[model samples]
Target: MTTAVLALQGAFAEHESRLKELGETVIELRDSDDCALAFDRLILPGGESTVQSKLLKERGMDTLLRRKIEEGMPTFGTCAGMILLAQHVDNGQGGDTQSGALATFPACVRRNAYGRQLGSFHTVDTFADMQVPMTFIRAPYLDSVEDSVSVLSRVDGNIVAARWKNQLVTAFHPEVDSDTSVHEYFLRM
Candidate 1:
């Protein structure tokens, strides 16, 4: 099966490389035309959520990609990608809220919940019952999730990873790490 990585912004190349290393054909979805390509799965990489969301809408890919995801296209999101997929987003500025991009995942997220870039750190945590490395860079943790969402992994009691049906999300960047366990899990799904 092929995997498509949203390349409008962020660490798309890293995800592509990881997928290729796993012997998967990878495609980069940079515009609406690219989104029309046939792919089995999708990966939304870490980056600025606002910028990525704006670009996706501007390029006319927002609605199309959302439809694909909602139609049971297995998707994996990391960092800002998780924010894009969340149904609700709290900017953490006293009730400031931002509209979700795809909003396919049924969860609420707090943007920059870990503070700024300086707050970034790395740790090994349990994900899908496996000990894997987690890299959080200005990541957003899931403050709440619907009953349909399955909590996958947490750091310090905060929900950092979860899965809801065909959607999988993490407030950390798994592409930056060498471990392929997370990617393998997504591939299997």
Candidate 2:
């Protein structure tokens, strides 16, 4: 299955490479126009959420993405990507650039919740009993969740991984470890 990676910026190459290891072609999605094709899934890589959202708005991809999701497009957003997919965002200390998410998943995310990039580290967590070694780089910890959402992983008592409907969001960069099972799951979605 072909999956499109939102390659506007950030660590998209890592995700692309990981997905490629699964024998799938990675398409760089620049805008809504890119979402027209019958892609099996979409990946929004971890980056700066406000910046990515601005780019989506500047490039007019936000509206297109919302429409595509409504049409049942399987999606995965990591880190900052998770902020874009969630329903709410608390920027900590009541200071935030954006408040709400795309509502793709029921969640409340806080950007840089784990501190800064220098605070990034690795952890071995089990998702559905699957030993997932993840690299948490400037990640956000999930605070709240909907009843239907499944907790896939966590770190320091904070929710770091969850699945809401067809959308999968992980606080760490699985791609950084060159792991593609996460991306593969999104593909199968």
Per-residue lDDT of candidate 2, residues 47-106 (tens digit): 888888889888888888877776777888899889888888888876553544365778
Q: Tell me the tens digit of each residue's lDDT in model 1 across 34-85.
A: 9889999999999999999999999999999999999999999999999999
RMSD of each: 0.8, 1.7
lDDT of 1 at 34: 96
For candidate 2, the per-residue lDDT at 26 reads 78
For lDDT, the strongest prediction is: 1
Candidate 1 stretches greater than 4 Å from native: none
**Model 1, position 61: C-alpha lDDT score:** 95
Q: Each candidate: what lDDT?
A: 0.93, 0.82
Positional deviation of 19 in candidate 2, in angstroms?
Answer: 0.8
